[model samples]
Structure formats: C-alpha cells, structure tokens
Target: MSSVHVEPVIAGAARETWLGGSLKAFREDPLALLCELHRASGDVAKFRLGPKKLYAVFNPDMLKEIMVTKAEAFCKGGTFAEIKRLTGEGLVLSEGELHKKQRRLIQPKLTRSHINRYAEQMVASTLAHLETWGDGQERDLAVDMMKITFDIIARTMFSYDSKHAQDQIARAFDSINHIATRKIRALVKLPLFIPTNENREYIQALRVLDDTVYGLIRQRKAESSLEREDLLSVLMRATDESSQEGMSDEQLRDEIMSMFLAGHETTAHSLTWTYDYILQNPNVEEKLMNEWKHVLNGRRPTVNDYPALTYTQNVIWETLRLRPSGYVTSRTALQDVEIGSLQLIKGDTVMISPYPLHTSERYFDDPLTFRPERFEQDRMKELPQMAYFPFGAGPRSCVGQHFAMLEMVLILASIGQQYRIKRSSTQGALIPEALLTLSPKGGLRATVHRL
Candidate 1:
C-alpha cells in the first residue's frame, strides 16, 4: 500500500511563501493588490492582512460557490467573533437552526408593508433633526448623520427613546464606534490595562451599551402588546416555530445589541461621504436638489414620497459605490475550490473586496470617476449583477439593506432640500479608518448654508 500525504487546509498552505513585504503592500491597499492579483495571480490569489492571512477570489462563479452553492461549509469567519462580544448570538452571528428560526420569527415584522407603514416615522425623525441645524455654520455630517439615524431607529424599532435613553445610547455609541473603527481587532485578546485609555474606554462603553439594551428588553417584555406600532413591541410579541414561544430575554438582548450597533454607524459613514461628494461635485448636487424641490414643493417628505424621489435614490446608490461603508467583505473557504489558478483549501479566508470590484477597469469605465447615471435602469445591462455590491451579495448579504438605503436617501433629500454644503477647508476630505467599517477619520466637516 502507498502511504498518502495530505496537504493541511489553512492560511499557510494558501500563501505558501515567506510573509515578506507582500504582507505590508497588502494591508495598506488590498484593493490595489486585488487588481494586481487578477492580472498577475489570476482571478484568485493569496495575500495577508496583518497577522490574519487570506486568499482573495474575484471570479463570480467562485463567489457564488462559497456564498451560495456550499455556504454551509464556510462559517462567518474571524470578524464575526469580534462582533459576537457585542451582539452575542443574534442574527448577525448566529448559524444553523438558530439563525433560520430567528430569521423566520423576525421576517414578518420587517416586511415591506410594516416598514412602509412606519416610513413616516423615519421621514419625520430625519426632518426634525435636520431642522435644528443652524445654517452658515460648519458641521460634521458624519456625527450628525448618525445622530439622526440613531433617533429614527429608536422611534421605528423601540418606538421611543426617552430623553435619558437617547443621551446615554448616543454617548455609548460614540465611545464604542470611535474605538471599534480605529482599534486593531487582532489585538482583542490582549490584556486590558488602565494605562491603555482607549482600550479601557472601549470596554467601559460596551458595558454602558449592554445596560441600555438590556433595560429596554426588560421594559418591552413588561409592556408589549398587539396594539403597539413599534418594531420592538412586535419583536417582543413574536413567536417561533409552533408560534407559542416568544423571544427569550437573552435572545432579545442580542437582537437589540445587533440593531444598536449596526443601525446607524454604517449608514452614517455612507451619508457623510455622500455629503462630501455632492458638495465637491456641484452638478450632481444641483440635479439632486432640483428633484427634491420639484417633489417636495416645500412640504416635508414622507414614506409616500419615496417613489417620486428617483434622483435622490440615484445619488445614494452612487455614493455607496464611491465610499462603501464596508469596503471589503470576506468568507472562509469550505470545500476545495479553484478560482482561476489558485486552489483554495477548506479553511482559507477569501476576500470579496467591493472597493476593487466597484473600481475595476474591466467592470467599470473610468472606475475612479463619480457617475450616478450608471445606475439608471436603462443602463443596468451594462454592468455585471455581482459587480456592484456595496451592501453585498448572496444570502449572507446585509438584511437591513433596504432599511438603511431608505434612511440614507430620505435623510439626504430632506436635508438637501433645505441646505447647501461645501467641504470645509479646515476639515478636508476625510481619509477613512480601516477598522470594522470604513469610518471617516476625525469627522466629515462641511460648511452648511441654507438653501
């Protein structure tokens, strides 16, 4: 009998050489590496991101294989583990039967009809917050954008944010997001020292978030009723499987944590870039403003107002292309797969970088240029379906994509209807921090002038 030697399935096998300067070139501009990899290493390539090494696959067929055909073999990978500390086993991190059951229970409540009914709440909250802004003053839209979305999610999801709750949650969100956007996820296991003020602050802020979310879950249980209109009330009353058991206290806490964390942060970053782009590209801003003015006619926008707001939607979509909040998404390899020439092992990490794909020369013309017209329905046939996935692609895509996009477009239109913005020389265009999300470093400062 011949002895068999099997190759181990891991990062080492995929990368197969000394870490070298290849690792550093990768960390700074993985998207650039992806472009080179496509040309030099074929469609699939191996590289490193700090200590966490990876294989990047850009082929659409291979992408479908991992994200769809054999999704079960690959898990959520390392990032989800970091997020798990915050959201626990909620939808964002849970797998198997638990994930399926949770999705079923939550699906009805987030239906188009349900979300549309509360569209007014979303529009109202957005307008109310924007109204308070003073014209002819400098502001950081990144911070303000999140503040409003936090308020909207509070109203739409929980149905209320007591003055105290709002203050506490926002403060906690600031501390948590600020750190999460800058801190190195690989260092999460390191001991926390008091001298490490940033780490100390991060841990303290998470505690605050836990308390706030837990208290709300308790309150919802005590007060949940069929008559309530808010999402929290609906979630509290939701039943699983046989429709007898409502969410457990632990489950509810995790769900709320997922919402609290994901609700506003990414949307805020996208909106911030949208503002910067609209200001820098005056022609696009003018066209968007014209649409808003014609549609609104000085009246506040509501959910019913969405269809008439086509240009606004286009602007939002285009902004996401240029400054995607989560620039790259990843999946762990499950089965042996060959994408181009590189053969991937079961445990290898594969990157589907939106930045490179969105800006790829083969997929897009002058990928560096900003062009909102690319999304016009008539032009849809020009681009590949999987090429433009800012929210993501396949079953594992962000569930709240519609909700987030709705919030962003409506808020941008409402605010743009009343104000004009210019990039602040003092603040400059923000360079994003490569942490959990693509966050605007410092903040997105712009001069706000009343329209």
Candidate 2:
C-alpha cells in the first residue's frame, strides 16, 4: 500500500459551486465533465453535490484498491441505487451477503461450459434476423443489433421462441431505458407514485416485463420434470448452501430480468459501435473480412470457430475499449479508507469512468484512433491492470462476460462473412449519448450488402 496523506486539500476545488458544484455540467455531459476534471486535476479529483463530497479516481492502482483490494469497504451507490427500481434485488443491485449468495447461485449458469452450449443458438438467431434484411437496404444497425441480441437472449435464457414475446420484451426494455435516462439526469428526483407521464410509462413497462417473466417462471414450474439446458432451468434448480432451497418465484423473476437487461443491452451497444467503427475505417473492415474469409470460409461461425477468429475478437475488444456501453460505474465508501494520498470518509462517493481511462494518452498510443491492433497480446500485456475493464473488475464484474464475448464474436463473424455494412449517406458523425448505456446519439444508420 502506498503511504497515505491525511486530510489533503482536495484538488479541483475550483470546479465547485454554491449549489452542487459541477452537478449541472455533470448531468448535461458526464463524460466530458469527468474528462475535464481529470485533465485539470490529474488522477484523483474531488468535488461536491451540495454538501456531499464525491471523488473521481482515474489512476488504475487506486481504482484497483477500490474495486479489488478493499472492495468490501464499498457498496453500490449513486446510479446503482437508482437502478434498483428496474433490477430489483437481483445480483446487479444486491449488496453484502445477498449479493454474494445471488452471485454464487447464478455464477454456475454463466460459466464457459454453460455458455458454450448457447453458441449455436446465438449464431442461428443472428442469421435468422439477418435473413430478414434485404440486400442494399438501409437500416439503423443499433436497432437491429438490439433486436438480434434480445432474441438470442430470449431463446437461450428461457427457450422463448415467439416473435411476439420477443417484441413485447424489447418494447418494455425500451421504455425502461428511456425512464432510466430521464431519472439519471433529472435535477429534481421525482417520486414514482407521482403519476407523471414518465412514471406512468415506467410502471406500464414494468407491468409488461413482469408479466412476461412471471409467465415464463410459471410455465417452467409446471414442467419441472422436463430436462432443459437453458439458464432458467439451472437457476430454478440451484439451492443455496445454508438453506438448500432454490430461488422463489419472485427471486427467479428478479434474476431473469437482471440477466435479460444486462445480458443484451451492453452487447447490443458494443456490436453497434463495432459496426460504426468498421464502417469509418476501411482498412480495419478489410482485415476483418479477410479474417472471416480465411477462418470460416463462408460457413456460419460456431463456438468451435471463435478460437480461430483472432482479428474478429480483437475488433470486439477494441470496440469495447473505445465505446464501452457501461462507460462509468459508481460506488460509495462504507468506511473511512485511504485511497492513495487522500482520506475518503464513509458515505463519500467514488466514480470510476472507463470512458476517459480508455481514451487517456497516458494509457494508450493515439487514444482516439480506431486501431484494433492495440489489443494484440504483447501490447495488451504491457498495459496497467484495470486500465481496460469494460465489464468492470473484482467481485461485481459482469458475470456474463464469457457469454457476451462469444455472442459478439460469433455475431460479428456470421454477419461479416455474409454482409458488408457501410454508413448510410444521411448518417452524420457519431455522437455518443450517455444514457443508461453509451449509445450513438441518433442511432447508427448503415446500409448492408451481401458479399
């Protein structure tokens, strides 16, 4: 541990104000504001929301202390507390013992062996969706990727095959995403019971989401004797160590909803960004095509084929590095602890933004350029730990990382092998919007052609 300084005068004090210093700017454009703070004040900077103190740590070593070494001293706070309305007490939102137990039960289902079983379904679902697109057709690749990933998650998680069911789930999630965006940026926190239009829409979306998830739970329970390989089955059969009991109906709903939201949205946005970058960089696109042709040779990608698709994997990694959907994550200190030189008091908040870190010149060469080659093994090994955590780090890191990677690689390979996508003439420069996830501002418009 580095020697700590006690009660150091917080840097970036000039950025504060009488009423929530930097709060307005943060709400407007968090990424830009945080980046400015980093540039002006170096690695560790402190500001305030009224009297409440907040710290933004940009150094990877300090971030590791918060996420790994002394993670137990922190709890999910700020945005995560707000997200509980949508995720309930599922693994993503839970803390302490509950989080540990939920993670324990759910972890087995997301292991590589379990996720590998879904690879065929992932490719098949992607191909089925691609088949609906006509050659030379213009489409919003962002929207298309969302639908494709949603369908794949639906099938692999619950054996849900109905287009109607998939559409309903997608629509509900859309509403939820919108509400989350509003809530996160709203100057005044509105109570859900106020019956505002946004509140009404949020409730309605939750109703639809609940109906679909609970219906699946009931249907599964009715056929308990049947053997299934889907995630729902594994979760239903899992028993806690102490109680030897599986999750209740409501518990199942929470876990299923968490997986559905976390599983698809990030992966979809990542794929969308990947396509956006590939269209902008011709050389990268050519390399990706060459890799696809040489590896699978026109055959659709299977789980076995992913190991050979090195460039395709690198493309996904670079996309995540450049445009991580979960761009920033927050945690509140549960105890007074020393992080590097500063003393953090209990209840003080810490914000770790991967967006700025990924683009920092100190961490990477030519940070803004779209160069997938930076992810090459030797180069990657040279970078600092926690410097590139799109899925986060430590205990609360994304549980479905393997599943997401496989799905993205297979989807890219399958689509790239059959189609060449280019930006539409009407589409403008990519402007990233920091909503619930970092999505392209107006969606990614592109034209697709069969190769």
Candidate 3:
C-alpha cells in the first residue's frame, strides 16, 4: 500500500456549512472547475460539493492510498447509492465478496482472446458505416462513433444479426444515460426523485430499458442458437466458482444494463477524442497511417499488429490523458481516517478528479500539449505511479479497461488505415459534459476522407 506524503489540507467549513463547491462545479462544467481545484489545493485538498458534503483527496498518490490502502473504509458513497435507483445491485454498486464473485464470473467474457475474436466485428461494422460517408462533408463524429461502437459491441457481445437486438441494446444505453445524469444532478439526494416530474420521466425510461434488455435475454435463451459465441451468451452461462450462484433474471438485467452503460459512451469518447487529436496533429495521423499501411499490407489489422502499432497506441493514450472519459470518481469514507493533520469522520465524499490530476502541472510536463510520444514505454515509466488513471487503480478499478483499450486500438488501426481524418472545425475544447461519464458538451465533429 502506498502512503501519501502527508501534507495537511484543512477547511474551516463545517459539514453543514457546505456550499455547492465541487458538485456545483461539476454541475457547471466538471472539467474546468476540477482543474481549478487542482491548482488551488495541492495533493489532498478539502472541498464541499453540494451542501454538507466534504470532498477531500484530489491527488494521485492520495488517490491510490485511499482507494487501495483504505478502500474498505470507503465504499461507493451516496453518489453510488444514488445510482442504485437505476442500476440496482450491479457490479458498479455492489460491494463485499459479491462484487468479487460477480466480477470473476464476468471476467472471462472480456478476456484478451475473447475480445480479439471480436476484432473482425469491430472492423467490419466500422467500415460498413464509413462507406456511407461522402467526401468533404461535415459530420458529428461523436454520434457516428457512438452508433458504430454501440453496433460493434452488440455484434461482438451479442452477435448483432437482427436490427431489433441492436436497437434494444442501443436504446437501453441511451435511456440509462438520461436517467443517470438527471438523478446525479438533483440537488437533494434520496428518494426526492419521486415527486419531481423530471425524475418521473426517468422512471419510465428505466422501465423501457428493463423491458427491452429482459426480452433480449429471454429471446436468446429460447432461440438457443448454435452460434452463441458473443459475450451475452458467455455471461448468460456464467456461474460462481464456489457457491455455483448464477445471475438471476433480475441479476441478469442489472449485469446487462451495467455492461450497456459501462461500454458504449466511454469507448465512443476515446475514439472521438482520438479522431480529434489525429485531425489536429496531421503528423501523428500520418505516422499511424504509415504504420497501418505497411503492417496490414491491405488486410485489416489484427492482434498480430498491436505490438507494431505503437503510434496508434500513442494517440489513444494521449487522448485518454487529455480527454479521459472517466473524469471523476467518488468514494465515501466508512470509517474515520486521518491524512497528515486533517482528521476525517465517516461520510465525507472523497472526490477523485483524474482530469485535473492527469493535466496537473506538477505531474505531466507540458501536460496540455497533444504529444502521443509521451506514452512511449520508457517515457511512461518516469512518472510517479497512479498519477494517470483513465481506468483508476486498485481493487475497484474498471474491470473492462483491457477490453476497451483493445477495442480502441483495433478500431483505430483498421479505420485509420482506410481513411484520412481532417478537421471539420475545432469548435470545442473537449469540453467536460460530465454526466455519468465525461463527455464533450458540444458534439465532436470531424471530416472523414478515404485513403
């Protein structure tokens, strides 16, 4: 376990004296205010986001120390509890051995080999969509990538042969995002959602999502197709190693919704940012193109090409650093803890803002610049550990990080090899829309050109 260099950061603000603070900043625009906080407080700053909610621990070293060292002392917090309104007891909110068991059961579906088998699906779906684009026309790259990725994950995970399956899965994801953001932004946390018409709509959306996902699970079981190699089938058949517990129908709903919620937008944002970076830095795109053209030899790139595809990885890493989709994570202290002289009572929300940490002046030299070469294996080793956490670190770290990275790499190589990306307009600063995941406030726009 790592210990943060105990630097005292104190706040006179009582738990009752809390103003909007970090949560308000999050409500305003999540990224900008967090960067401001990083500048104001050093390693472990004290913040009051929303009334009475004290958010401490905003630095990397302390991030690891708390999330790993004292992780049990901190669970998902009210933010996570709030998420349970929609997600139920899915892996995202579930704690204790149950989480471990659930993660173990689902782990095999996202293994490297299983994901690699899905590479062809990613490539084929991406090309099929790109083929419809006309030359020099502007398009919202964010929406297009969302459509492409949503379709790809379905095929790779559910063998998306029918329009209905794809539509149900995609609708579930969109509906969930809408409900989550609305719930997260509400001023009063608890069951306050019931009386408001705004939250009333979310209830309807959740039901729609539940129905569609449940129907798919049932339909697949009934069909019992011989061609059931997708992640959905894999998950449907998964059982705990010891107790032999399997996902119940409701449990399956939670897991499917969790997968749908977890996968789509984050990967879409990475690719969107990657596309934006390649557009701005023509040299980087050209280098990636050269690598793809040479190694692929006109065939679609595969896992075999990953090692040689260094620059492609560079672009993705740089995007993750600059515009990571996992902008902020919250952990509530379950036990009193002290860091330096600051004494923490339980119930304080520790806000982990990676956007500020990743771009922190102390951490990355010229952190704002778009340079993929910074991720060169040797160069990456120079930084202090946990300073960069697109997927976070520790026991609760994202289980699907490897799957996402592979999906991004495979898609970038296949698509970049076949097309040249041009800047449609640089209208946004990768603005942090920070709802459930960090998203661009304005749509991500770029022009796609053929090789």
How many clashes does each candidate structure show, in the order listed? 0, 0, 0
Evaluated against the true structure, the overall lDDT of model 2 is 0.83
Model 3, residue 23: what's the lDDT?
Answer: 62
Indicate which candidate wins on TM-score.
2
TM-score per prediction, in order, is 0.87, 0.94, 0.87
Over 4 Å off, model 3 = 1-23, 162-179, 189-197, 224-229, 240-245, 338-342, 425-430
Estimate every model's Cα lDDT from 0 to 1. 0.71, 0.83, 0.71
Q: Candidate 2 lDDT, tens digit per residue, 22-52?
A: 7777766777788788888888888765555
> Model 1, 122-232: lDDT tens per residue?
778877777778888888787788778888877788875644566667677777665654443332355456558877887888888888888887776676355686666
Q: Candidate 2: TM-score?
A: 0.94
- lDDT (tens digit, per residue) of candidate 3 on 31-110: 66556666666666666656655554665556767777778777877776656765777877787787887788777777
Better of 2 and 3 by lDDT: 2
Model 2 C-alpha RMSD to native? 5.7
